[model samples]
Structures are given as C-alpha cells and as structure tokens.
Target chain A: MKVVVDGMGGDNAPYAIVEGAVQAQKEYGIEIVITGPEDLIQKELDKYDYDKSKISILHASEVIGTNEHPAMAIRRKKDSSINKALNLVKNGEADAIISAGSTGAFLTGATLIIGRIKGVLRPALAPIMPGKNGPFMLIDCGANVDCKPKNLEQFALMGKAYFETVMQVNNPSVGLINIGSEEEKGNELTKEAHKLLKEAPINFAGNVEPRDIPLGNVNVLVCDGFVGNTVLKTIEGVAGNIFSVLKEEIYSSFKTKIGGMLLKSVFSKFKKDYDYKEYGGAGFLGVKSICVKAHGSSDAKALKNAIRQAKVFYDNRVIETITEYIENSIADNDENIKAE
Target chain B: MKVVVDGMGGDNAPYAIVEGAVQAQKEYGIEIVITGPEDLIQKELDKYDYDKSKISILHASEVIGTNEHPAMAIRRKKDSSINKALNLVKNGEADAIISAGSTGAFLTGATLIIGRIKGVLRPALAPIMPGKNGPFMLIDCGANVDCKPKNLEQFALMGKAYFETVMQVNNPSVGLINIGSEEEKGNELTKEAHKLLKEAPINFAGNVEPRDIPLGNVNVLVCDGFVGNTVLKTIEGVAGNIFSVLKEEIYSSFKTKIGGMLLKSVFSKFKKDYDYKEYGGAGFLGVKSICVKAHGSSDAKALKNAIRQAKVFYDNRVIETITEYIENSIADNDENIKAE
Candidate 1:
C-alpha cells in the first residue's frame, strides 16, 4: 500500500515533512509518495537514502499557507500539494492522504474533491485524544461549527462507526456532549439532538459533560463543532497555559530555579502527560481512506507514528465497517429525523 | 456587617463550616451568626472564642445533604438550615448567607426566599476562575442550564455589574463563550444572544472559545448554564484526572517510587495546582446579598477563602450595581430582540 504525504503541507514543509516521510518508509517498510514542488522535494530527498525505489514524488506547483482560506484555496489551487495528494487517494493511487497544513483546506478538499460516503450527511473530523478515562473520540472537533439537530445525529452515527471499526470497540458507546447531564438542559440544537441520538440504532450513552472527556467515560463523543472545538481547544489551552505558567514560576527566583533543577525529570514527564502530539495525531474521520491530520508543529517522531496509525486504519477496513453501520442505521436515523 | 453561616451545611458540617465562620469573625472583625441545631453550632463555637459578643447562634433543626433534591428540600424544609440562613439575610438580620450544601437548595431558597431584583430575568451564579489575563467570571455556571437570548443578554449585564463591583475593573470586557468567534457560528440561542450583547449598553468583546478562558481573553463570560457548566467541569476534571494519572505512574515501579519520594515537595507544588478547592468558591450573582458557594468537599481553608471572597462581594455592593445595570440594559436588549 502506498501512503501519499503532502510535502508542502505544515509549518516545516519540504524539510520536516520530507524527512518524516523518509523516516516512515525506512522504519515501517511502507511505499511513500510525496507531493509538492518536484525540485524542492528532490533537494529534501537528497538528504536521505536507503532505497530511491522505496519513495516517489508527485509534482505540484502551489502550496497552501497557514493564512490561506481553505475553501478559496481548494477552489483556486486545484493543482496544489494538498489537492494532488487527495487526488491520489480518489483514484486509488494511494491508500491514504495525510496533511498537516490548513485544516479547512484538507477538510474542504477531502469532501468536495475526494467525496463523502453515500449515506453520510456531512463528513466529520474525528480526533481521538487522551481523555480523563483514556483515549476518546471527539467528533466534529472543528468541522461544521454551526450544526443542525439532524447534523448532530449524523455526527453520532459516523463517530460510532469509526470508533467501532478503527478503534475496535464493539457497539461503541456514543454520547451527546451537553452542558449538563439532565434531560431538559442545553440549547435548541442539543435539546433536539439528544432525543434524536437516543432513538438511533447505536449504543447511546445519554448526555455527557465536558469534564467527563478526561475520564474516558465513553467510546464515541458527539457534539456540534462549536462545542466540540471549544472542548478540544480548552483542554489544549488549559494544559499549555498552565505548563507555561509553571515554567515561569519555576524560574521566578533563585531558590525556585534550584528547586526546578532537582525536579527537572518529573517536570519533563509532566509535560508529556498533557502533550497531544505525543499521542500520534488526529484523524480525518469521514474520508474514504485512512487519511490522518497531523499537528502543524509535528516533528519527525510524531509524523512516523501517525503514518503507522494510518496503516493500521487501512488494514482494519474502517470504510467497509462504516458503510455497513450506515446501511443498518438508515431506518432508525431517518425515523429520528422525522420524529424530531 | 453580619454574615450568616449555615452550620448544618457542607461535608464536615457544624465543625468546618462553624469553625470557618468563627475564624472569619475573629480574624476579619465581622459579626457572625451560625444557623443550625443550636447545640451542635454552640459546641463547635465553644472550641474557639475571642469575643462571644461578635458571634451569635440562631436555632434551626433541619439539614440538607449534597444528594437531596434542592427544590423539593427548599419547599419541604422551610425551617431548614439553608432557608433559615437565607431568612437572616432577607430580614436584615444578616448581610449575607454562606452555604456549602446543595447548590440547587441554596439557589432555590435564594430565589424564592430572598427573591430576585426588579426586572432581573434570572439570577446568575458567577464563579471567578483564574484565566490568562488574570481572574475572569463565568456567569450562570449552573443556575439556569437552559437560557434564551434575553436571559443571556441580562446575564451579560449582571456580569458587567459583578466585575465593576467585585472584580473592580473599569468596563470589564464581556465575551460570550461560543464554539467559534463568528456571530453566526452558534445555534439559535447563542446567535441571538450575540446580537443582543453586541448592542447592549456595555463593553462587549464578542465571542470567545474555551481556549480563551485560560488566556484570560474576557473578563465577564456570559453563556447559558449548559455551556458554562461544561467548560467549568471540563477544567475541573482535566486538572484532577491528569495529576492522578501522573501520580499513579510515578508510584507504579520501585525506581519511580524512590523518585517520587525525592520529588515529594515538587509533586506537592504540582498537587497544589489541580486542587480546585484552592481557588475560593463560586459566587451566587444577582442575589440581593452576597453569597458564595464552596465545593461540597471543602475543608476549613476553602470555606475561609470563600468567606474572604464574600467580603469583597459585600464591600463592592455587587447586587446594587447589578440592579442599576439591568435597569439600563432593558431598552437596548428589547431593541436587539426586536431586530433579531
């Protein structure tokens, strides 16, 4: 199986991305296809060599920057690295497409370019992270921020399938993230979504609070993009902001600095506890293949790990399982929609 | 000013709550009135006394537990400790009431017993938490889980008043906690609330995500109870769960166990953080008098800190300021509603 890597995607493009692809091919024995400017990709490829036959490059002239609008870029830059990489997956040239560049561009390009599953309402981005319980999937983390009740029900269906097939959790428990656990709580969208999810043909875990994320309360978590994004970003912001504060405190005085030295190893371990990059990377759930979205600041190690995760995702045939789940769920999903 | 303490409230009832009240009286030079079984309150009070004249015990027989239904208890136990304490505030026998019992019971009694201000749509519970910019208040944390656009607009007004009084900032920046920063990114309630707050007579900073909370992006955060509660609990859960996992890892092996011993002091500092009790309790906003809600598991220190916060609330005349703000906000709020 060949893995398509966006050579122009991410902050350290052409260098870290190229180096990461080479490391994965060498270590994991996977065929790699790198997409970007052919000349720049060659210069980076010259830095690494075990077998030139193990890796290939696809030429693309344009690169999407961080500030570029995702929809606009996808529309205008049809031959961009991200689009070229996705095209490889669409034509079955590659088993998956991975990118660390603009999330919007990847999401927009993946759906509008590569296409969505037949019964899928909207393709969601599901990323699993270390929750209070263990690893839990947060659906629509940033995709479709303003969701309708029907959209949330669809998110739950997609998330349940992904968790069960990819994560191998049987009858994966699906929870609607509400502000409170009570039935009458949440805004209009959530209030209606709660009723819809309960009636769907899935293991509904009822309502879950944001705090429950860390506790690993359920296998699949569903929410509108706005709330899900807030939860994911809050976890990141709280973890990052606190660590930064602690660093300032640890070096604020001479005695504390000395104390910080004696406690350096523990602090390093503490930093690892809250680091999302340490847990591989995020998955773009609704895509046909095993495409994953690595963090923009992903290093070589994280990228390699993400590549391995994508291989496992492909081997699991997650798309086939999701298709079956969707087919089985149509009657119930439609019933809930009509009922609500 | 006299502060009424519910002696039968909290986990370590009569002891911690009573002792905390006695300490407040002696240390802060405030008159204290303890409400509970006369005998138990007197017994706890007898443990310390710098001035009996400064402290008084009011008799009440009923008790409220953390698990009890708050509204039912408020209605059934009219002479309960919470109601009795609130009566003291209502009758001008005490300037404020402090209870660590059921939040529902306190809020119910505070609303029905002490009553709401004229034209105040809902009484929001504002909790001041540490943020990036400093301490910011999350209004209506759980007082009302479901809210309308008008309710949130009024919450913003009350939050601004709270900051001016207790937080003491000139026109504290108010932000709505939403999934995205865009006006149309939220569902019906949030979208309408955005329009209302933007036009309200206050300094509105627009929408803020959960990540912004840690960065201290906004001073007074207004959101319906569901979103606010989810954000509050998620932070609480993450803080507790992450620390515990790291602690377990440190003690999992013999070598790491020894490392844990040498790292005890540093770990203690780390532990000091994840401790939610350290951040003084949440305040009940929009009440006629200042009221602080401590965690159910609060010890003496937590209770003491909560009381200290109440002192600031009382001195600032937060309720009076809210009254003025709400009175001024009605016209703009109505116009916003009509425009929507």
Candidate 2:
C-alpha cells in the first residue's frame, strides 16, 4: 500500500515528516509520497539512509497554515501541501492521506477533494484514545459540532466498522457518551440518539458516562463533536495539569527530589502511556478515501506511527467497509422515514 | 442564619452530617437544624463538643436511598429527611438547605417544593471548582439536562450574582464554555446564549475553552447541563485516574516506596487542593430558596465545608440577589421574544 504524507504539516514540519516517511517505508515496506517544498524535504531526507525505491517527493509551492480558515484555505490554495497530498489519494496515486496540519483544513480538503461516502451526512473525526484496558475510538471529536440524531446513529455505525476492520476488535460494543448511564438520562439529541442506537444493528452498549472512559468500558464511544471536544480537551488539560503539579511538588524538597530521581523511569512510562503519539492520529471517517490526522505537535516517531495506522486502515479496506455498512443502514432508515 | 442539614443523608450518614452541622454551629456562629430520626442524630452529635443552643434536630420517619428515582422518591417519601429539610426552607424556618445525598432527589425535591424564581426558566447546579488561582464556578453541572438559550443566559446571571455576592469576587466575569474561544464557536444553544450573555447585565467574559478551565480564565463558566456534566466528570475522572496510576507506579519498587514516603506530605497537599471537600457543595441556582448538593461520598470534613458554604450563601443573601437579577434580565428577553 502507498500513503501520501503532508511534509509541511505539524510543528516539526518537513524534518519529522520526511524522517517518519523514510522510517515507515523502510520498516513497513509501504511506498510513501511526501509533499512539500522540494529543497526542504530533500535536505531532511539526506540525514537518513534508506531504500530509494520506496520513497518519493512531490513538490508543492504553497503551505496551508495552521491558523487559516479550513474551507477558505482549501478552496483558494489548490497547490498547497495538504490539498496536493489529498489529491494524490483522490487520483488513486496513494491508498491513504496523512496530515498533522490544521484538522479543519484537512477535513475540508478530504470532503471537497476526495468526497464523502455515498449517503454519509458529515464525515466524523474518530481518534483512538488510550484507555486502561486498551484503546477506544471517540467519534466526532471535533468534526461536526452540531449533529442530528441520525448523524450520531451513523457515527456509531462508522466507528464500529472501522474498529472491527482496522483495530480488529470483533463486534465492538458501541456506547453513546451521555451524562448518565440510564437510557432516559441525557439531553434531547442523546435521548433520541440512544433510542436509534438501541434499534440499530450493532452491539449497542447503553449510555456511558465520561467518568467510565478511563476504565475503557466501551470499544466505540459516540457523541456530537461539541461534547466530544470538551471531553477530549478536559482529559488533556487534567492530565497535563496533574503532571505539572506533580513535577512542582517533586522539586519542593530534597527527599522528593531523590524520590523523583528514583521514579523517573516510572514517570516516563506513565507519561508515554497517556501521550497522543502512542495512539498516532485521529481518523477522518465518512470520506470516500482514508485520511488520518496526526497531532499538530507530532515528532518523527508520531508521524511514523500515523503512517503505520494509515497502512492498517488501507490494508483492511476499512473505508469501503464503513461506506457499505452505512449505505445499507441509512437506506433502510430513509425508507422507514418515507413510509411514515 | 439557620441551615437545614439532612442528618440521614450521604455515605457516612448521621455521623458526618451531624458532626458537620455541629462544627458549623461552633465555628461559624450559625444556627443549624438537623433533620432525621432525632435519637440517631443526637448519638452522633454527642461525639463532638459543640454549642447546644445553636444546634437542634427535627424528627423524620423515612430516608431516601441513593438508588431511588429522584422524582418518585420525592413524591412517595414525604417523611424522608430530604423532604423534611426542604420543608424547613419552604416554611421560612431555615435560610438554606444542604444534603450530602442523591443529587437527583435533592433537585427534584427543591424544584417541586421551594419552586423556582418567578422569571427563571430552570434552576442550575453551580459548583465552585478549585482552580490554579482561586476558584471558578461551573453552572448547570447537572440540574436541567436539556436547556434553551434563555435558560443559559439566566444561568449566567444567576451564577454571576452568586459569585459576586456569596464568593465576594468583584465584577466576576461570566464565560460561555465552548469548543473554542471564538464568538461563533458553538452549537445553536451556545451561539444564541453567547449573544444573550453579551447583551445581559453581567460581566460577560466571552468564550472559554475547557482546557483553560484549570488555569482559571473566567469566574463563572456557563453551559447546558449535559456539557457541564461531561466537563465536570472528565475533570473528576482524569484526576482519579492519574492518582491511581501514580499510586501503582509509586509502589513498583523499594526506591520509589522510600521516595513516596518522603513526598507523602507534598502529595497530600496536592490531593487536598483538588479534593471536592475544599469546594464544599454545588448550589442549585435560580431556585427561590438556596439548595446545595454535597458529593454523595462526602465525609465529615466535606459535609462541614458544605455547611460553611451554605452559611456564606445565606449571609450574603445570594439566592435573593440572583432571583432579582434574573427576574429583571429575563423579563426583558421574554418581552423581546414575545414582540418578535
């Protein structure tokens, strides 16, 4: 399989992107097409010794900034790295696209260029968050802020399909992220979504609370993007705050400093377990082609992990599976709505 | 001011509740009315040295369990401690009511008995969370699951009034908790609420992200209950998960164990700062009478803190202030809506 990588994306840009692509091509035996200014990408590539056969670069003049409006940038900058990389997948030159750039830009580009799967309302961002037992997929992390009940039902189907095919979680239990675990315990959107999910064809776990997320109670937790973004950001903020406070306390006294020194490795392990790099990137689901978004601050290892994840997505044909599942499921619902 | 305490409520019931009331009377010079089986409350109160003239008990025959449906329990269990305590406020016998019991039951009882402020659409659960600097109030934590934009605007006014009068923060700023810090960065409810908050007579601080919560960016953060509950739970879950993981790592080796002993006090201070006990309880704002919901697992210290919080609220006439503020602000909005 081949993956097109946005070489000018993320904080560590062309260096990390080029190095990650080289490492992925060498280890995973996947062909990679890196898009960026040719000179910058080539300069970084010279530091690594790898098979020249599997690696290639596609030069692009413009770069879509992290701060720009997504749809505007995608519409105006046709030759930008993100747009060009997405075009490679649209043209069947690559199996998937990976970018650690602006999430909005990437999603907009993917939807406009590659297009959405047949009958998909809105493409959702599904990021695999590390939990106690393992990892669970959180759909619509920041993709669609306002979602209808039908959208949430579709998200559950898409998330389940991706989890089953890519992560190999068999018949993954799908849970709606709600304020309470009881079926009748949420806002109107969730209340309606809950009923829809219960009747849908999937392993529908009842409403799951945000508190149960760290315990890994469900394989696929679904919610509208606003709630999902708050949950995701709160988790990130709390984890970061706790560690910073711990670091300050560890340096407070001589005894604590000694203890910190002794437990350095343990602390590192714990931090690594919570790091976004360990989980790679969030997948932009519902698009016709596969698109994965690495974190904006991703390093070489994170970029490599994202590439590996994209390969797994490509090899398992998860996008095709989701499109077929949603097409079938939504069609029945459409007919039911029509009959009523 | 006299505060009604549910003597038969919470996990450490009768003991923690009675003890906390006794402590509050002795320390804050506040009169307390303890409701339950009088003999059981007396037995617990005997363990502490407190002013007999300041503390009194009201006899009640039944108790509301944690697992019962809130509305049904309120209707059926009229002789319960929660019902009797709420009746004290209804009969003008106490200034405020505090319960370390089931939140749903407390809310149901308060709304059904004491009623809402005349112009207020719904009461909001506002908890003062301990942030990096001081404390910030998170409104609508779990009161009304579904809310209108007008309800949120009223919540912000209620929250602002309480923050200024009770918490004594000068010109406390109210911020709309959103996915982003931009004006147009939320769903329909928030987008409308933002405009309302901006126009209302309060210190509207614009939009705030969940990640900025720990840094104490705003005095009062307003949202519908679903989003508020998720943010609160995410904070609680992340804090608990981090500590549990740290505990496992701290005991992994002998050096770490020795280091843990040295850092024990430092860790305790950090934990204490983040503990729910320090923040006392969540106040049900927009109600005609003050109602505070202490955590279900509250101990003596937590219950005592809650009693102290109720005293602060009573002394400042926060409930009355909020009632007046919201009555004026929402009446204007209601007129505008009617005109349209």
Candidate 3:
C-alpha cells in the first residue's frame, strides 16, 4: 500500500517528517511517498538510506505555514503539500494519507480534496483518549462549532460504528457528555441530542458527566464541538501541567534527579501511556479516504504510529462498515421522520 | 451582624454544624441563628457549654438530601433549613446566609428566596479559585446552563466589582475563557463575548485558555455555565487523581510511610495550600445579600471558612460596590445602544 506523507507541516517539518518517512519505509515494507519541495525532500532523504525501492518523491512546490488560515490555504494554495498529499489519496495514487501538520490545514484539505462519504453530514475527528478503560473515542472534538441536535445524533452513530470496527468492541455504549448524569441536566442542544440518541438504535447510556471522562466510564463520548473541544483541551491542559510539575520535581535536586534515574524506565512507560503520538493520530472518520492527522509536533515515532493507525483503519474495513451503518441508520431516520 | 447558619445541612450536621456556630460566635462575634429541626439543633447545642445567649434557633421541619431534585424540593419542600436560612437574609433578619448542603438546593433557595439584585439579567455564582498569584474570581462556574454573549458580559462586570471589594485588586483584568488565546479561536459565544469584553470598562484581556487558569493570567474568567462547570470539575478530577497516585507512591511501603510521617508537617502545609476548604466558599453574587455555599461534605473547618468569608463580604460592603458598578456600566451600554 502506498502512504502519502505531508513533509511541509508541523513545528518540526522537513527534518523530522522526512526522517519519519524514511524510517517507516524501512520498517513497514510499504511504499512511502513524500510530498514537499522536491529538492529539499531529496536532500533530507540523501542523509539516510532506506530501502530505495519502497520510497518515492512527489513534488508539491507550495507550502502552508502555521499562521496560514485553513480554508484560505485549501482554496488558494494550489500546490500546497497538504493539498497534494490529500489529492494523492483521493485519486487512487495512495491507499491512505498522513500529516503531522496544521490541524485546520489538514482537515480543510482532507474535506475539500478527499471529500465525504455519501450520506454523512459534517465529518468528525475522533481522538482515542488514553484512559483506564482502554481508549474511548470522543467525536467532534472541534470540527463543527455550531452543531444542531441532528448533528450530534449522527456523530454518535458514526462513532459507534468506528469503535465496533477498529477497537472491536461489541455494542460499545455511547454517552452524551453533560453537566450531570441525569435526564434533565444539560442545556438545550444536549437535551435535544439525548432524545435523538435514545431512539437511534444504539447502546445509548444517556448522559455522562465530565468526572466520568477520565475514568473511561463509556466507550464513545459525544458532544457538540464547543463542549467537546473544552473537554479535550481541559484534559490536555491538566495532563500537560502535571507532566511539567513532575519534570521539575524530578530534577529540582541532586537526590531526586538521581532517584529519577533509577525510575527513568518506569517514567518513560508512563509518558508513553499518556502520549497522543502512540495513538496513531486522530482519524477523520467521515472522509472518503482514511485521512489521519497527527499532532503538529509529532516526531519520527509519532509519524510511524500514525502510519500504523492507517493500516488498522484499512485492515478492519472501517470505511465499508461506517458506510453500511450510515445508510441503514439514515434510511430508518428518514422513515421515522416521514411518519412523524 | 446577624448571620444565619443551616443546622441540618452537610454530611455531619447538627453536631458539627452546632460546634461551628459556637466557634463562630466566640471567634467572629457575629450573632449566629441555627435554622433546622429545633429539637435536634437544641440537643446538639445542649451538649456544648458556650454562651447560649449569643445563638438563637429558627425552626424548619423538613430537610432535603443530596439525591433529591433541586427544583422539586424548592417547590414542594417549603419549610426546609436552606429556605429558612435564606428567608432570614431575605427579610433582613440576618445580614447573610451560610450553607453546606446540596448545591442545587442551596442555589434553588438563594434564587427563589434570597432573590437577585436589581437590573441583573442573570445572577452567576462566583467561586474563589486558589492560584499562584492568589485567588481569581471565576463567575458562572455552574449556574446558567445556556449563556448568551450578554450573560458573559454581566459576569465580567460582577467579577470586576467582586475583585474590587473582596480581593481588593484595582482594575482587575477580565478574560473570556476560550479554546485558545488566538484572536479567531473559540466558539461563537466566546467570539462575540470577546468584542463586548474588549469594550468593557474593566481591564479587559481578550481570550484565555484553561491552562492559563492556574497561573492567574487573568483576574476574571468568564464563560457559559456548561463550559465553566466542566473546566472546574476537570481540574478537580486531575488534581485529585494525581494527589492520590502520589499518596499511594509515598505511603506504599512501611519505610516510605515512615518517610511520609517524617515529612508530615511539611505535607500538612501542602495539603492546606491545595485544599479548597482554605479558600473559603463560593459566593452567590448579584443576590441581595452575600450568600456563601460551602461543599456538601464540608467539615467544621470549611464551615468556619465560609463564616469568615461572610464577615469579609459584610465588612467590605461587597453588595454596594457591585450595585454601583453595574449601574454605571449598563448605563454606558444603554447610551451606546441608543446612539446606534
């Protein structure tokens, strides 16, 4: 399978991105197509020799920086690496696409170039949270800010199908994140979404509070973009703060730092468990091609993980399962709507 | 000044609540009125030898537990301790009210009995957040489920006045809590609130993220009740989880437990610094009288802090300052609206 990598994105562009592609080609036995300025990409690739036959170069002259707007770049920058990489996956040149670039840029390109499945509304990006109950999927983490109740119901349906296929959970429970775990807890959108979710022929667990999120009380956590984004960011902020404090404490004194050496291996495992890079990036589920976006600061290791994730998406037949579920669910919804 | 205290509130009520009232009477010299079942309160008080003349009892026959619906109790359970305590403040029989009961019950009573201030569109419950730079006021921590842009603007005005009287920070900087500090980030409400907050008379910083909260980056943090509640709860969850993990590590073995004992004094200081009880209680601003609601599981110490907070609120004339500020700011808004 051919995987297209965006070599002109993220904080550590060209160098780490290109290195990751080289390492993946050697390890995974898959054709790796690096997309960026042909000269710079070739120059980076020359620094390391991998399996020559497993890698190729795709030329994309233009680059989108971190400061550039997503939709603007997608519309205007014709030869941007993001656009080129996504286009390769759409036009049967690549099996899947991966990017460690601007989230907005990658999502914009993925939506416009790759397009969505037939019956899907807005595409949602679900990040698998590394929690105690394996990894729970939180959909619409920040894709659509202004969501109707109908949009949330659709998210739950897609999320359930993804977990069933990729994670292999049998009838995974879907939950709506609310203020409290009661029928009458959330605001207007959540209140209406609760109704739709209950009747959507899924294992709906009603409402789940924020406290239950880290505890991994449910498999698929659903919410509108506003609430979902805040939840994701809060977890990120708290986790980051804790790590920073732990790092300082581990090095504040000679004794603690020495003690840290004794526990270095242990701490490394802990960091690995919480790291988003290990999750193989957040998959854009509703898009036609399996376009996964890694964190902007992804290194070689994270890029490898993102590529591995694409394989899981392909191996588990995620796209075909999601298509079938969406068709049947929409047909039922249409019938129900018409009757009402 | 007369301060009404709920006798039958909290997990350890009557005995602990009576002890707290006795301590407050001796320490703060404020007349304490215990409101609950008169017989139980009298029995608890009879066991304690103090100046009985300084304390009085108000009879309330019914009590609501944590499991009861807040709205149903407010409508049906008329003679509850919370309602009676609030009524005392409403009728001006007491200067303020304190309760460590169910939050929903306390909020219900405060809104229905104690009443909201004049011209206040929505009354927000402001909580004192412990930070490195002291406490910053986070209004709308969990009051309004659905907030418009105007409600956020009101939170800023009330939070500004609160800092003036309580924290005594001159021209405290107000911030709209958003997904990111970047200008174009956050949901629709925050984007709209950004414009209004910038025009506000108080020192207005544009947008602040969740991570910025602990650093005290802004004096006031404003958002809708849903987002605010999630942020607050998430911080609590993270802090609690980390502390527990550390505690287990420190006290895992007998030798480590001995080390913990050796550092017990230092650890106690850390516990006090981290404890929410030391920060007083949450204040129901924009109400007629200052109403401080402690945690439902409050011990004697948290109750004492709430009483202390009430005295400070009375001494600094918090209500008057908030009233004066709101009058001036909204008048400016009225003029701007008329001009347009």
Chain A only: list TM-scores of all candidates.
0.93, 0.97, 0.95
Candidate 1 true-interface contact recovery? 0.55
Candidate 3 lDDT at B141 equals: 79
Query: Stretches of candidate 3 above 4 Å error?
Result: A246-269, A338-340, B249-273
Model 3: per-residue lDDT, tens digit, A1-340? Answer: 8899998987888888888888777777889898999999999999997777888888999998767788998889989898889889889999899988878888878888888888988889888887654688988887887789888988988899889988999999999988887787778999999988989878999898887787676999998777777787777776665566567665666655655565455456557756888887888888888888888888988888888888788888888888888899889978988999
For model 2 chain A, the run of ten residues with the poorest summed lDDT:
A236-245
Candidate 2, B63-176: lDDT as tens digits? 998778999999999999999999999999998999998888999899999998888888999999978766899999988888899889888888889988997898899999
Indicate the DockQ of the complex predicted as candidate 3.
0.44
How much is B19 displaced in model 2, in angstroms? 2.4
DockQ (Cα-based) for each candidate:
0.39, 0.72, 0.44
Native contacts recovered, each model:
0.55, 0.75, 0.35
What would the per-residue lDDT of candidate 3 be over residues B1-340, giving only the tens digit for each residue?
A: 8899988889989777888888878899889999999999999888877787789999999898877898788778889998888888889899989988877888877888878788787788788886655677788978888898988998899988888888888888998888767778877888888888888887988888776776676888888888888887877766665556557666566655554454454445545645888887888888889899877777877888889899999999989988887888879979999999
What residue runs in model 2 are displaced by over 4 Å at the alpha carbon?
Answer: A331-340, B46-52, B327-340
TM-score against native, each model: 0.86, 0.94, 0.94
Error of 1 at B94 (Å): 3.2
Q: How many angstroms is residue B161 displaced in model 3 relative to the true structure, after the best TM-score fit?
A: 1.2
